[model samples]
Target: MTDASSSLSSLIWADWPAPDHVKACVSTRIGGFSPAPYDSFNMGDHVGDSPANVVKNRARFLHLCRLKRVGQWLTQVHGTQVVEAKDDGKVREGDAVYSHEANLPCVVMTADCLPVLFTDEQGSVVAAAHAGWRGLASGVLEKTVATMGVAPSSVLAWMGPAIGRHQFEVGGEVRREFVEHHPATDQAFQPDYQSRGKYYADLYELARIRLGLIGVHQVFGGGFCTWKDERFYSFRREGTTGRMASMIWIKK
Candidate 1:
């Protein structure tokens, strides 16, 4: 396996750097053996892609990394449920997984939805969460940070690639859900000009507000647009699409 510093041209896992003993990476839809819909580097098994091809892609991902296989994969129901990572077990069902153990990677898969990575100041614990609009509105980020057992102020969050605000148009009912939940949430959505009863939502800003409300001030990496970027897989752009992984772990 190539060391993180030695392989910077992977196209996918290049943006995130290994800093302060916490290793992290967000894979793009490049470099693998799947075909057509899955194309390459498709990590999701339930997306109707060929199992063997998915396995090959996963193996290739592992082969490129110095770390061992990731510990806990989640079913990702887009709910706020958070699970503790187990040393020995299959992936569990949930939107978030947290662990203090080193070398046990916590991973979240996404196409257009957000996959967020978290760690505390000392790097003892790390987590990953799948936050769709539903999950975001329902407090997935808050719950995931709380599961780490660190003060929210000491944690650092990294927002991975997601559907950009320009592409995330939603109806008034969706806006109503947030406003009803928190009257202040009205600021997150702006009226869409092309369609009535529809508004463009800024998910990143919404997440920032949610994280800030809970005191997690050290946040980073919210620039990529999965829907507009051809290099990354986007579910909104291609209804039947493969998934990319966002992973974080403390080094042993």
Candidate 2:
């Protein structure tokens, strides 16, 4: 468990040039009420963490972030579906959530999968996407940018923590899926010398390639390895573990 005194300090704020009205943060695995394995700050209720503990942790998160509304958490299916975040209190089924509304946080929970936060230069819209290998390969980021209803050039993106390149080993099929979409993606995978048919995948590079293709050139905040950094959760490292959240919102 993490120290209560360090709870507020544990959040990793996005270091980007987003507009003044745009607020974003990614929670670390510190400061909460869960026990070992899910120990301390586990934001995902869908994981094995106690629902009550997840609730308390989320409450502490909102309190620390000074957010007025509950986050719009999706039942992420590793697909390319993008939905608008509303105050309807419905748990939508999608890999991404975008919102132009104030105080309505668009959030994505991730352990090792990439969590991407988006916002327009005008700060009128903000979004969060859960980009696992499946979703990333299938165009979740593209769908998110398209849903923002703004020119892709006007959007700024931030790649949150995830499994880093060296730590993310993948099978031949995973590499083939990406290379099949864009042959250039082949460069993002390097063969694992010791393990035949296995390769190390760079999710960050793949995300940058996707965002660049969609005209979002002002991307920032990559290089965090969830597997190596214990501050965040990593399903790849611990099969049964908690999840962290990356949240973005427009200020009221």
Residues 13-120, candidate 1: write the lDDT tens digits.
424433568978887777777788877778899999999987777666655666675578778898999998876748799999998887888888999898889988
Model 2, range 144-220, lDDT digits (tens) per residue?
99999999999999999999999999999999999987888888999999999999999999999988887899999
Which window of 10 residues has the lowest lDDT sum in candidate 2? Answer: 1-10
Estimated TM-score per prediction?
Answer: 0.93, 0.97
Runs off by more than 4 Å, candidate 2: 4-6
Segments in model 1 whose C-alpha atoms lie over 4 Å from true places: 1-8, 11-19
lDDT (C-alpha, whole model) for all candidates: 0.83, 0.91
Candidate 1: worst-modelled 10 consecutive residues by lDDT: 1-10
Clashes in predicted model 2 = 0
For model 2 the local lDDT of residue 33 reads: 88
